[model samples]
Target: MYRLHKFLWELRRNPELAERFRSDPDQTMRDYGLNEEEIRAIKGKEFRKLYQAGANPYILLFGAVHMGVPRQEYYERMRSQS
Candidate 1:
């Protein structure tokens, strides 16, 4: 049920919304161990960066925690940080 790639790509498309999450992306970036700078850096890149094979660990974790992944999965991924 997780269209993980599509959802992440959408987040790539919409950066302002991404900024809203920036203050605390860590709870989402938990398993991947990404920090705010890397999260902001990845989002700050041009659109082409989304298409690159270099999947941002932040984006991957963000989608899994915020958008496409299941609510249960979200809670599981975020519980400790919560």
Candidate 2:
């Protein structure tokens, strides 16, 4: 959601933050002030949930890439949920 952009912005702007997030998402998300649901969705790699929760598409894509999830996998997950 609005918060997702904040994460994305941080990731884009701060290489150290990105590295920290890549290394420890749970802690980083918590430190970054994401709510429980947002942290859950991110930890679970539930892109569809994140998307439905209002994560920007571009930011979501960035998150997916950061998580090393393939674009095809993201689409499949979205389609399965749909």
Candidate 3:
């Protein structure tokens, strides 16, 4: 979880890394030590999975924003799951 947090943080702060993530999220997650499920969740843009896995909401928001998801759309998607 900590590693995922740090990995998200890096993706948020670094443009190059963010570009890499946008281009190939699975590979990026793999390079960052995320497990297959974690990689799948992120690569698939399954934020609900990440949240259920104990990811921080604030960071998840940042991730969603960084990935170009509209704020309202992200909120709606998350809300629908609850």
Candidate 4:
């Protein structure tokens, strides 16, 4: 969970890393040493699952944005999950 948060925060803060992530998310996540569950949640855009798993909402939102999810779509998905 700590590693997942660190990766999310880094994805939020670093443009180059964000670009790399946009290009090859699985590889980038693997490079970050994220577990399979973390990678699955992210790659599947399961923001609610991430939140339920203890990820910070702000970091998740920012990371989702960096990953090309529109704010509206993120919110809609979150709401639907609830």
Candidate 5:
């Protein structure tokens, strides 16, 4: 989660950097400790599960970080209603 936070921070500060990383999924998986075969599995990994894993949660990062959506939006959209 901490790593995800840091990544989100980076994405927010410089989304171009995020795009560069995402551009090469190969390097990204390798950096995430996936072996060749494991990388292949990652290629098949569902995008939603990736968001759930939260290690390098790109979906949230993409919206909250890359899109520069105000924190208020996150609050309104994500705050627990219960």
Candidate 6:
């Protein structure tokens, strides 16, 4: 979870890292040492799963936004999981 949070923080603050992630998410996630569950949640855009896994909602939303997911879509995805 710490690794996931760190990666999310970096993804939010570091434009270069975000671009690198956008280019090759699998590789970027692997490089971040994220486990399969974390990688899957992010790659699959499963925001609710991430939240359930204890990610801070604000960080998750910011990271999702950096990845081009709209705010409404993020909320929709989160609600759909309920």
Report every candidate's CA lDDT: 0.46, 0.78, 0.83, 0.89, 0.49, 0.92
Top of the candidates by lDDT: 6
For candidate 5, lDDT tens digit of each residue in 1-82? 4433454456556657557556886785456455565345334433244344554544453535353455555445445322
The C-alpha RMSD in Å for every predicted model, in order, reads 14.2, 1.9, 1.4, 1.2, 7.2, 0.9
* 1-82: candidate 4 lDDT, tens digit per residue: 8888888889878999989998998999999999998899899899998898888899899889878899999999888875
Q: Is candidate 2 or candidate 4 better by TM-score?
A: 4
Residue by residue across 1-82, what tens digits does model 1's lDDT show? 1233444645557675345446655444432445554445334432233324455556555654443355565445444322
Q: How do the predictions measure up, each by TM-score?
A: 0.25, 0.79, 0.87, 0.91, 0.36, 0.94
Give the per-residue lDDT digits (tens) of candidate 3, residues 1-82.
8878888888789999999888888888889998888887776668877898899999988978887887887788777754
Residue 61 of model 6 has an lDDT of 95
lDDT of 6 by residue, 1-82 (tens): 8888889889989999999999999889989999988899899999998998899999999989998899999999999975
Q: What's model 1's TM-score?
A: 0.25
Candidate 3 local lDDT, residue 40: 76
Question: How do the residues 1-82 of candidate 2 rate in per-residue lDDT, one tens digit apiece?
Answer: 6666788667766788888988998889888788888888777778887788777878887767766688898888867764
Candidate 5 Cα misplacement greater than 4 A, ranges:
29-82
The segments of candidate 3 whose C-alpha lies over 4 angstroms from its true place after superposition are: none
Range of the 10 consecutive residues with the lowest summed lDDT in candidate 2:
1-10
Model 3: residue 9 alpha-carbon error in angstroms? 1.0
Q: Alpha carbon lDDT of residue 30, candidate 5?
A: 57
Q: In candidate 6, how many Å is residue 7 off?
A: 0.8
Q: Give the TM-score of candidate 4.
A: 0.91
- Model 2, global lDDT: 0.78
* Stronger candidate by lDDT (2 vs 5): 2
